[model samples]
Target: MMIKNTAIIDIGSNSIKTFVIDQEEKYSKIVGFDKSMSNGFDGNKINNFDTFVDSIKNSINKAQKQSSSKVKNIILITPTSKNKNHLISEVIELNGAQIEDNHLRQLNKSMIIKYKTKLTHCFKSHYVIDNKIITDSPIGINCGSLSLNAIATIISDEEIKLFKNIFSKIGLNLIFIYDSSIIYYLYLKSLNLHKKNIVFIDIGSSTTKILTIKDEKISLLKTLPIGSMNITNDLMTLNISKDFAEKIKTKNIDLILNDHSSVEIPVWEELGKNQKQTKSYEFIQSIVTARVDEIFKLVLSSIPKSKFFYSYLVTGGGSMQLNLIPYVKSKFGIELELVEPKQVKGIPTFWNNPSIMLPFCLNSLIENGYIDKFNLFKKNDSFSNKIWYKRFVDLL
Candidate 1:
């Protein structure tokens, strides 16, 4: 059963984006792309359902036209608010048979049933076969019994229903939904970069998602109520429109660009009036750095000892604040790596913008056989399909 072309919609606080891709054998043909302002989404919730649907429709239609394909299935991705981390362990007997992929699949299925009321997503931490610990999947090894630890996110039923209703209004099925942070982490892990210990961060428009990979297995997932939008709002202290504020925030707030506090930038009270004032780069830096620093402090509170991780990788619009790397080094003494999606054959150069890169990665991961066919977790018969989310990844 080969699904030829599919659409990926990324709904974020600031915008709605879509990519209509033609999944090919060796490469994904990216035939369509769009990023549109989100209406109906008032940062925290969908306040106007009708307007929200319109917004999503606009984004989807623009991309679909470019692809010349009517996309029916959507792998929806969002930076959802309700995600929280939980640790679960499950054990099973193999009866001295060789541990195969199905063995772990069954083990995970059992674990989900026990916690079906809670799990939105689950990722393996590691496995112990016959009382011996292993990070690699014990697929071919003969084992009497196997046990595993996993990190899973708990999503609210309310959120899932909201997704359903939104898609229903748009006249499309909500084939699958994924939390952006979790999917972003999954895409990275699939690269097999050999990063043993890492604290991955994504600063989205209204939320910051953090996930930890310790000892080559995922350990935790977290979401915080902070993002680049805060920085833009903070710049409104000068009484500029949100549009103008966002422009300068993106243009000036950078490591190489914003470093000279001694330099001053011109500020306009009303550009048409030609009235102007001067503010030191230091002023803007203070406002921007303060919020970014707070974001990291909050991350530390959630996952203490993040400083000990071998790598601190970050993405999303906030990562464009190049100064953050040196700033975190000075404040917390942690090195931060700005992760960009690697160039797969079909990805256009502009598609790598951190804010909208998740869809591209999702398309690539699907083609590369990195993502499991796990249907959000096949907990019941209603999700009828040969479900994928296997090993969630074969890393463990």
Candidate 2:
């Protein structure tokens, strides 16, 4: 069987990652993978646009070298900065004509034009025709009027322009740009794990995102400025390097203290001189625990008052710290489970790392035909048969 290939570029605040996957009917393998650290933010916004574009180009070039096919288009997963989700409804008068695809397109187009925000993804929750709710497509049905209820995930137009400019420089077309939170929600729903309300927390290097899933759909999304890096910075108060602080954060030391116990860690004083520093496990735990508490508090404040019927799920590189599960449970009173890529089949073990889970989830979604059927990308209406449309005809 011939395998189809897809490439994904995930741009985050802390790193840029590129991955190429080749898949048959039911299985897929990661043929290429590359990553580069993002330059820390300049003030409140991302550093230089040109510098970030260059980093992305370098990662994509490395991935292309490992793949057998050239990557001309990519699925871009963007950060949640300046992104918002809104539930909108619009009524269309059919004038006693049958509803058609064109009418549905017009409705969506009107919403976009009215809001003036660049759409990242839009999901049609349901349609009401003549006061009757319809879950499926309402096309070919005779009706005087119809209403569309949709959830529009959007970001600033400036951000969209920035990504388009970056991809243009690299000779790649942006196939789809999805908010990172939406990607996680889709991935979780694909696993059939949303029979009940689910609270998802993704702790990235620079920011943490919280998503609320109700009735198997995303109801709310909030991003906190604090993340795992804050804990690393907090450890810097001990006069340790960032790298060393990161190591301490991920170390498999017990955070739960029945009694006061101290652990001595070696610190580099000079080329050959090292000093053993005694630090109580409670002290180290206090630093990390404080940050985690603040993150959950913000998340709780954002979500509506409701009971969660399912386990809280947590993912991302920051959430991989040892004993994080217990820390969250003790502070938040909710047991949290770390999401493992092993739950997703047909992918290599190397692709299971938390650092690249976003790309991995995207590959799985594409392989299962979810993205194309859902119209996740912006549609091109021009008559010209561009190379992108020719290559991804099914998607268009």
Displacement of the residue 34 alpha carbon in candidate 2, Å: 2.5
What TM-score should be assigned to candidate 1?
0.83
lDDT (tens digit, per residue) of candidate 1 on 61-173: 88888776787767777546665666678999888998889878788778777866556667655688887755556888888999877656665666766776677677776
> How well is each residue in 1-396 modelled by candidate 2, as lDDT tens digits?
223445688877667777876777766776777776665342137668777777788888887788887777776787647777777678899878999899888877776566433445665555778766454479888898888766677666666666666787888777567767766766775676525578888888878888887655567777778888888889878867677887777773445642547756667555756777889888887887777778778777777764345458888888877777887677667788887665443334654667677777777777676555444233431112363344335332
Candidate 2 runs further than 4 Å off? 1-6, 23-28, 40-44, 90-120, 126-148, 257-261, 264-276, 307-311, 343-351, 376-378, 381-396
Which numbered prediction scores highest in TM-score against the true structure?
1
- CA lDDT, candidate 1, residue 234: 90
Pick by lDDT: which candidate is best? 1
Model 1 global lDDT (CA atoms, 0 to 1): 0.71
lDDT agreement with native, every candidate: 0.71, 0.69
